[model samples]
Target chain A: MNQTDAFHRRIDEALHNAQLRQNFRSALTGIMARRAEQFPDETQLQALRDQARAVRANALVRQPELLERLEAKLTENGIQVHWAEGPDEANAIIHGILERAGAKTVVKGKSMVSEETGLNHYLEHHGIEVIESDLGEYIIQLAEEPPSHIVAPAIHKNRREVAELFQRFHPEIPYTEDIDQLTQSARVVLRDRFANADAGISGVNFAVAETGTLCLVENEGNGRLSTTAPRVHVAITGIEKVVERLSDVPPLLEILTKSATGQPITTYFNMISRPRQPGELDGPEAVHLVLLDNGRSRIRVDDELLDTLRCIRCGACINHCPVYVQLGGHAYGTVYPGPIGIALEPQRIGIHKVGTLTSACTLCGACGEVCPVRIPLPKLINRLRAEAVDGLRAGTAVRGHGSMRKPAEAGVWLLWRWLYTAPSRYRLFTRLATRLRWMTPPWLGAWTRYRCAPRPAQRTLHELAREEGFRNE
Target chain B: MSDSRERILARLRANRPIEVPTPTVYAKPLGWDREHCIASFMQRMQAVRGEVHRIARDAWVDWLAGELPARGIHHLLAGNGDVGDRLASALPASIRLSRYDHPIEQWKPALFNDIDAAITHARAGLAESGSIVLWPDANEPRLMSLAPPIHIALLDSHKLHENFAAMIAAEHWANGMPTNALLISGPSKTADIEQTLAYGIHGPKQLITLLLD
Candidate 1:
């Protein structure tokens, strides 16, 4: 099947699965409620949003400069930094570091960027064992599934499913469907891996340019153990994660946790300035930071589209998105899912790749409204829709911009343009539509498949006006 | 610089976005009096299942001696400092207090398996978020706040700041920062399982803050 067919099949499967739909509904309802609670005052919310948007905008505008400053500071702090132009290069760089360190076992914190690089598969293929330490990540890893949500990776699995997963994976432990017991099993299982792992990998929440510090946010202490317990700590992040100063971190951090999981702050906000210094008792002895630039700089070049880089990966847009609530993240079949996913995936992989994702939006404007950084998600998705067919304005077109444009569709649009622009053609067309209302088809396309297409009225508005003795004509 | 770094930097520079003004600082000192800040801090902390005690600074050791046994905590892992020594001298013989003096490599198994709880010193606390900040050093390792199933943190009342940004400015973190700094709000938790709030998944399951007044 083609990409579009595959996407539709996934959506169909998700919609038909009552379990998945109910899971998403309950999860999102709780998230939306807690998020609202966190931001009780609209005035404060707007002010924080403005502050966060400004901070991200400032970072994007000066991205190149801030990145350089960050590199310099990290180097000064004794962190070894590497840059990768794409996923393969990034994986190779990480592998090379592991090879030098003789690291066979790796524990990872939840990092979306690592998923973008397909890091786990790459390492496993090279005979390395990489364990995901986050409880949600651990659950999904055991099930051999991709994360179904950004903040809550295994949000698709209810408690019974999780207990079953634990029993299936760790058969030695007695089976229990209790939530606390299920969590305890994962803790016991991953704790050993963390304690003995040769290296730890995590994603950066924000890279502070002013202090050369890498900040990671997590409610689970897995992030801390993954970064600290292992002898070598490797952090991988996209180039856009940098902020200009120390002060910029607070507003961004504050909004991120609240937006992502509706927590005032995650349980742990870790700031790593460097590897374990010479005198420090424990931390990673060697710290390596890899900056991946997989088509981000290209996206940043477009003035209006540059807003895509403003995301803090809060997953708030996903929670509020109406279309997303119907189908979980897996239905999108991309690394990112939901408002940000549809908007961003097509950009990373050419529009020809996932451009069909643009069809999966209602544009109800909820995602844009809830975005803490004020990213115009609807506008960007709408732009992508146009870009998918007609292509963006002149030289600014995205990859495979006109690939989805069909000759039949284009012809219909052209005819529509012709008929709508001319007064005589429009009047004639409307007269025919009104007189032939009985002939209107019950089905036109997939849109009409769910609901009846509107049939023309018995008389045109002008005819009614003429009957009423009003004559603008 | 590596070739990839140079190339990536070149691409970013070539694709430089339009200039935007630097942001005006939005995080401000809450301006709450000490009493209000303390109350707010206690409330926020407790909301997330954290235990807090407003005890006099000198009396914290005695309070822990009384409280740790009540919780049935026996093996206490503590940093090799004033608090560790005090716990050693003051606590009854029933509770075994282990000092984190040697390198972690020497006792990884014990740290992961044997220790029941740990006590770490907090650099500051934030009332806005009910977070206790820790900057681990040679005396207090990074894992002190992370590894053990139960963690007890000691914070001075004066270190409570209105918010994270205010604390950063007051600490002048940009001047010099430790290898690892953390803001721990409560015990490690996860609601990933059907949105069920399960505490102490990977990090400390219980976080008790003995606020020194």
Candidate 2:
């Protein structure tokens, strides 16, 4: 159960599976291509990105005021709000709401927040049968697997694999390899559950402080159904999702859809201002908004760490990450994966727990380039890597800042620094390494396991320059 | 709950960064007139697999009457509005009519299984994205636009906006919000199956725009 062991085991298994590698490769390649096509005008895309970054930054700067305004507006509009500092409290609040409504079964739309809190498992432990309405989510649920990709949770599985999984669970329904048939099969099953479920839960894409509205963006209508068809609806989100104004929504929404799925707009953009009004024919009679802190408020306090919250959960960074393309989501052994995970997990779980993840980055800068909100993910990952060794920030804030600082590793780095700082020692070391090159082993530790061993150059660059009759200016 | 809320807000207030002013919303305008909006809306809608039919204002019911039976639709759900009421009175008995007149609990099973299609009114249309904005209320309800297999939206040309930002500013949505406001661009779809496009995964299978002048 140790973080390092779990991550290493999952990573080893993932790298050895050729099929999983192909699945991530094909899916990410297609997503990257479509994302490029959507943003054909470079100048316009940059303008939109800047606008989005400013809106998010403004919201974060004024978060406390905006959240108070949001709670007041939502209360005025007839929505009950609750707060939780961690996952346990969040899950408990949701469970209490469902219990008050006397709900036994629940239908859920796609929610990464719910996953972060492990809501499904929590509810099921309390005797609630939860059905996932989103197709990708439903598929993964049937397989009893965590989501592999944020946007496409079931993207790691092929059509044949989905068909097999569906048949294993719902044998009464005929099986077919056709994607349409497979999709329709999920539709038929989840629709039945949606119709009968007593309560619904969903995630918030953007909660507008100006209008006290919770906006949900989705291509499938399941988000609408999950929030509408049931007697009670519970919407949970991180506190950072709130925006300052209604007009702020347009550009953010525009960038989110294009960056997330390369769509002009999704099939449904559902905004809920309140529960059903007096004598309304449909919609949840009671709506609850649970604002989860879960270390985000602490994350907000640090200026450098706060930029990680600017992520819209678009998954563009994930789609464009070369490391993620090779390893996939499951290999990270966390709720979130890819560049965002490497940067965020170490902070949320503490540097001591998952700090090793920071070293996985190639720092190719693709994730930063495609990030709609300009999160500077590579820079943040590099920051985490340093934080693991000896963070400049207070250890009480991030926890275990210098835990990865092993004496051996520290000694090696210190010796290297000592030698490199002086011209005489550097010259002697280079001379000894070049002369001893024939005795160098073909394999090093984990570094040379997947790579060739490094050997010193036959002559230092300074020696070559001297031989060529050139002098330092 | 109160304790947690207070502490969370306190932490946020204490650690909040330097204030940055909200930037002006930057949405590219189509810079086109009504005819251009219609053409652009149609082209974009069609590109996303939406069916756009330019019908005369009074001929929508007649067109619906002819089209429902041709598609073998036996039961249809409509709202309690002008067009919905008109369809109820005019359609033949062969095509059964269902209204979202009562709370969904009254006929949850029928609404989920029996209805063949649903028709709702559009408050506005975005020309750039080929999307219809629906303000669902007591009479129409949210599921009327989402639950069924087919979504037939009646859009008026006079209600067209250049884009989403234009619609928000013109309508003064910042002043007030609805129970549910929706922007539907096309039918339900997903590429989750190894990135293969499949329609009608959990929502409507088709999105038909009855554009009226």
Candidate 3:
């Protein structure tokens, strides 16, 4: 199936799934309420958001220099830093590292960058086993599915589903739906993997330049285990995740956890400076960091769209988005989903491929309001819509796919514009519509499929205004 | 890779947004008194399901000796240093105390599975977040606090700071950073299964902080 058709099918499936909708509704409602309680002082939250925006803006302005400095400092601290222009290079670099280590098994923390690169598939194809250590990620991995949410990968699945999945995969362990027992099962399985894994991979939350530290924020201790247990550790992140000073991390981290999970801090905030230093008993013998650009440079160049890069991947916007709550993350059919995904996916993948993803938004601005970094998400979505329309009209490859716009819809819009521009024509059409209101069709395509169509009033508002002696002034 | 690096950097430089000076916005201190700060720390820690124990400076040894057996903590893993020596000397002969004196590579599976609890010292504490800062070095390996099911952290009251920003600024982390430093707020927990919170997924399920005054 074509991308547009597939998207619509996914949306249809999601809309019909009452259980999925209820799950997301409750989850998002709880998340939103907790976030509100976490930031009781609105003024302080806004001030901190403004400060975060400025920090991100400044970081982008000095991105190249900051990244270079980060590389030098990390190298000085005995870390091997590799730069990848895109996903292919990133996967190749990581695979090369694993090959040199002769790694058969690799443990991974929740790294969205790796997801974007399809690293698990890539490594598996090369005969290297990759295990996700995070409980959420591990559950999804066992089910052979993509994460439905950024933070909570298996949010769409209920405990019963997970119990069944664990039963299917872990036959040795008795089936139990108890959260603690389930968690213990995963821990027992993953602990063995961590002990035996030759290489570990994780995503960096923030890379501090001055201190040469790669910081990871996670509630689960899997992140620490992924980075520490194996002989070789590889950390991958977007080029945009670097900051100038270690001091910059605290404020970002403060807003990150509060906005993401409504916590003052995550359970574990690991600041890794280097591989096990001299005489250090534990930690990876070698630490490698891969900075993946993956079309972020294109985003960096666009003046209007550059603010989208300020996203911290906290999933706050996703939790607050009205369209997202209804449809869930899988409907978007992208690694990153929701308000941020609508704006970002087009840039990362060709706009033509996922251009229809922009239509998923109601443009409700809730995303922008809750965004800790204050990215104007609605404006970016509108921009993509406009670009898609223009691309359709011009048949241009430079813009994202215009395949979503049907010729019939375009013609109707053009006709509506023509009538609206001329008062006489518009009045004449309204009069005709009123006269022939009975002949109006019940089906107005998709719009009237689920709801009643409005009929023309007996008298036009203009005619009523004239009879009432009301002047235009 | 160098070519990719240069190309990526060049593109970034070419597309760099208009430069703005970095903002100087440190978080305001809570300014709570010592007692209030400790209380707040305990409250925050408990909120995340972490256990906090306030002990008089001189009573820690006696407290651990009495508590270990009652808590079913038999095989305790600790750092091979003064702290470990003190713990070993104080604990009763019934409890098995193993000192982490060698590289974890030598006995990875045994260290992670055999120990019931691991005790380590916190470099500092953050009152606002109720987190303990751990800078694991040769003396204290990282796994001691992570591998065991129960993690016992010893923290001094004087080391508590109001927030993360205050602690980072005061400590001058910019000058130097440890190879592996962590700010642990609670034990390993996950709310992944239908949003039901469960502890000890891959790390310590019980995080017991012994706050020394």
Candidate number with the higher lDDT (1 or 3): 1
Cα lDDT computed for each candidate against the true fold? 0.91, 0.89, 0.89
Docking quality level of the chain pair in candidate 2: high
Give the range where candidate 2 chain A is weakest over 10 consecutive residues by summed lDDT.
A391-400
lDDT string, candidate 2, A1-473, tens digits: 76677778888999999999988787777788888899999999999999999999999999999999999999999999999999999999999999999999999999999989999999999999899888899999999999988889998998888999989999999989998898888888888888999999999999999889999999888898999999999999999999989999999999999999998889889999999998789999999999998878888877888999888999999999888999999998888899998878888888778887887799999999999999999999987777787723554456568888778887898899999999899889888888788878888999897999887777777889989999877
Would you list the rank order by lDDT, best first? 1, 2, 3
Q: Give the higher-TM-score candidate: 1 or 3.
A: 1
How well is each residue in B66-98 modelled by candidate 3, as lDDT tens digits? Answer: 999999888988897878889878999989999
Task: Please state the CAPRI-style docking class of candidate 3.
Answer: medium
The local lDDT score (0 to 100) that residue A372 gets in candidate 3 is 96
User: Model 1, stretches more than 4 Å misplaced?
Assistant: A391-393, A466-473
Give the CA lDDT, 0 to 100, for residue A125 in model 3. 95
> Which model scores highest in TM-score?
1
Question: Which candidate number has the best DockQ?
Answer: 2
Residue B213 miss distance in model 1 (angstroms): 1.4
